[model samples]
Target: MEGIEGGGIGGYWWWAAASSAQLAWGINFYRKGYAGDSRFMPLKAFAVASLFVGATASAAVGILRASGVHSVEDAKEVGASIRSGLGIPRRARDE
Candidate 1:
């Protein structure tokens, strides 16, 4: 999909910014929960992990878009390359 422009913080940058904000919020909540009580620890931990994963994925997409990897195929290739670099095995896919 084409990125939205003209307005402030439009396009892929928006995703990155939002993701960063979410990560920050998650961390804050996690710290607060950790310091306050042990009952909410699991929920807080889950939130932090979820946000972190979202941020990572969003960052990757932002980087790919910024690098001119517009097509879906190109994005997939880039993801595969990253996975390979991280020693993650690729699953078989029907072309």
Candidate 2:
């Protein structure tokens, strides 16, 4: 999938979260591969990637929905607490 562009705050956070997840999965798969009962496969990898994307999108959407936010700016405000908690840099959410 096309990732967010220009390394916006949200985009950067998404990359961090997704990359971390992918890295963890890679480690898990490597370990499993050495275990002889590995279930790591291309389809499983795809599924994991899909799940990560879905989760990130859902989280952003959910924050927006929960806060009655209808725009990027609104999303920024709504995501403030979370973004701060995650140590993501603050930026104007408005495009």
For TM-score, the strongest prediction is 1
In model 1, where do residues sit more than 4 Å from their true spots? 1-10, 33-39, 75-95
> TM-score for all predictions?
0.55, 0.35
lDDT of 1 by residue, 1-95 (tens): 45542233346777779778877877777666566478877876887889888878887777766676778887788889999999988878825
lDDT per residue (tens digit) for residues 1-95 in model 2 = 33332223443455456556655765665455543334656666676667666556656654444445667776667678788899987777535
Residue 78, model 1: lDDT of: 81
Least accurate 10 contiguous residues by lDDT in model 1? 1-10
Residue-level error in angstroms, candidate 1, position 19: 2.1
Candidate 1 to truth, TM: 0.55
> What clash pairs does model 2 have?
none
Q: Give the distance in Å from residue 58's predicted Cα in candidate 1 to where it truly belongs.
A: 1.0
Candidate 2, residue 11: lDDT: 36
